[model samples]
Target: MEYVPVWIAIGLVIGVVGKLAMPGRDPGGFIVTILLGIAGALLAGFACRAADIGGDGGLAIHGAAAVGAAVLLILYRLVMWSRTR
Candidate 1:
């Protein structure tokens, strides 16, 4: 239960930051932000598990996760845009 709020807050922050990080005409709201954040967390965990690096200390864990998520989101947007055309 305690983790829920923590995750929510983290999600909001990540979403807002993500929005700011990639400028210009992204369409989304609170729900979209939450989804993006969740996706980010999931991607992070998956990468960690696949690489077998989460068990040990890594200087780039958080950075890698954020970057990975941002990349995914960007790709998503691009695909959506292309499809709409």
Candidate 2:
């Protein structure tokens, strides 16, 4: 709802950072990275809501989103790599 915009912005930043974090061929290119980042943010935001980890928006949420995005990028890389094998 209200958080959608924030998530998109965060995703854009995290996706760019994730690209640098994961240096290699992206099977789906930048678009995929951006999508993964958005998914990561959504996942983190939901998890935070469920866990009540951090009340409302804050830096903690952004940090969590970054970690989530990184993990997703790694997973995406592994999956794409394994498919080639």
| TM values, all candidates | 0.60, 0.79
Please report, in order, the local distance difference test score of every candidate based on alpha carbons. 0.59, 0.77
Question: What RMSD does each model have against the real structure?
Answer: 3.9, 1.9
lDDT of 1 by residue, 17-82 (tens): 766666555466445755787677557645665687645434455555556566666676677668
lDDT of 2 by residue, 34-70 (tens): 8998888878866876788767867777677667767
Candidate 2 has a TM-score of 0.79
Cα deviation of 54 in candidate 2 (Å)? 0.5
Best prediction by TM-score: 2
Query: In candidate 2, which residue ranges exceed 4 Å CA deviation?
Result: 20-24
Q: Looking at candidate 2, what is the lDDT of residue 42?
A: 77
